[model samples]
Target: MSGIKIIVITFLLCLFIINSICKNDICINKSNGFYADYTSLNCQTFYFCFNETLNKTLQCLNSSEPIFSTYRQRCIGVNPLYDECYLVNINENHENCAWFSVQLSTTSNLTYHYSCLYPFLFDLESKGCKHYSQVQCNQRFEPKDACDYHHPQIHSSIDERPCWLIPSCRNKTNGFHGNQLQECSSYYECKDERFLNLTTCPKNMHFSDKSKTCLITLSNCENSTKF
Candidate 1:
């Protein structure tokens, strides 16, 4: 190949990888060539390898062709198989939620719209709502706020007020307590036996007894001991 062609090839490859190898070499055992970093943003960004080594990480942000199209071997605005983020441009409404009415070439008159639920965002590859933190999308959406609660028996005596009051807090100056009646959802932060408020975890989330904070849960962990 000509020198100019080789340079072009190298530059295109650089779009996949750079000279700086990341500390966490995600490409340590790969064969070679372009590969997407599916760990977080799906394939909006990717890496290139040669001889089982990761070179650098590159992205497909802020461009007409904003997505790495592995099938086409380059960046493209849209691919029926894996993209909807760019379609976001067609609609000026930039809330975390949106509706897409794309008319695909192969499928005539087939238009569909989508709305991403809270704590989740629209994923181009999956063409569905995925947790925002896990997918690389063009917009931002806030997660649902934690639910609110009042002491079940604010009128009752401090020592026996609620079903889940920690017996330990009565003697201490300040501490946190969990609600067994509303297990994995509600808790209290008390200054001695008197305190301000009762808090609940966000939708579907759980409270961690060890940390006194709301957290994502995958199992019936009644309480999270891990921070």
Candidate 2:
């Protein structure tokens, strides 16, 4: 192909990829008005489209309000749950809501911790961390497991990465491997070092990485203690 034609094709391909993905692209087929970009665990990025063309792509950065609310159709106040939650200065005795981050290989949101500082808790109304005494949000004494934020079924229109991209099971010759982001209850059994079979534990049992088996006893999975 001629160089000019090749360049044109490359550009078109990029656009196609963008439209296929959610985070970087939202101008699919004459989109007019604002649309949310489902990226990095939240619908933050804003896109302005009209007549099958994207006019602007905006970000909620360098401002107090960074979270984009689709209901409001605009950026809102400061979001304490903006990114990864961390324990910078924690009080060992204090009961606080701590969060753990879980990375998904195929999801747009790699992971984000949503815990407030030591003395404060995440306040939904204020849209930021505030004194725990004033906020009615649920409080936990300890941070939940990373798997708590994950779900076994990823019902997304976007394409998921190949099995090779999965770090835990990529090189496994055989045996079950737990997916931390998909909760510990579900796991993938690797076979012949090249195939994967999705497996879930029997009801009331969760997969256990420590013992490499499912058991009726509680395991460190989402709400396992409840069972």
Candidate 3:
């Protein structure tokens, strides 16, 4: 019985090895005859083919998976000969595609095979080259005699009027004064009589009479004594 158990274990192990070999062979066969050329731009290289099946497969591979097979199903059964493939060359410096690729592999049903020749889709902007129109706009912003005056100065102060009076006192009125007052002056009396009655006068002004008149001493009043 022990010898029989050993034989059974060996048979299962052999079957597992055969299954693995067949799977690898299938992958190898699928990779054969598929070729892509990567064109680099802005330090990134990309490949594009109009074949729908290949395109769909690549799109699925690019996305996060667990849904990879479901995504792959969108294009896998289509004829490979008629399908196009797009491979975006990842920019090492940019890291956007690299991170995306890692996530895609982790989450998807597709595995990266080093033997496969993945192509790149060329994008001029990604290659560090600017379009002609963009170059023109960049030139317009450069220093030029025609635009020197038109370009606003970097540092400018608003033409602010001097604050001649405190903001709160601008509309307030001066209060009446009795005789023995040294001089007549303008004072800030709040429109609300209660505020005038309750609030103390500011340092530069003084309350003259009980009626809410505040006084600013002025030397030019005609009746200086009645101020």
User: Against the hidden true structure, what lDDT does model 1 obtain?
Assistant: 0.47
The TM-score values for the models, in the order shown, are 0.25, 0.24, 0.18
Greater-TM-score candidate between 1 and 3: 1
Scored against the true structure, residue 33 in model 1 reaches a CA lDDT of: 52
Per-residue lDDT over 133-217 for candidate 2, one digit per residue giving the tens place of the 0 to 100 score:
5556354443222222122333321223442234343345477766555566566665444224567777877677667887676
The sequence of per-residue lDDT tens digits that candidate 1 reaches over residues 167-190 is 223333366656554665766564
The TM-score of candidate 3 is 0.18
> Candidate 3 on 172-200: residue-level lDDT in tens?
24443322222323433333111121244
lDDT of each: 0.47, 0.48, 0.28
Clashing pairs in 2: 30-52, 84-113, 85-113
Choose the strongest candidate by TM-score: 1
Could you arrange the candidates by TM-score from highest to lowest? 1, 2, 3
- The TM-score that candidate 2 achieves is 0.24
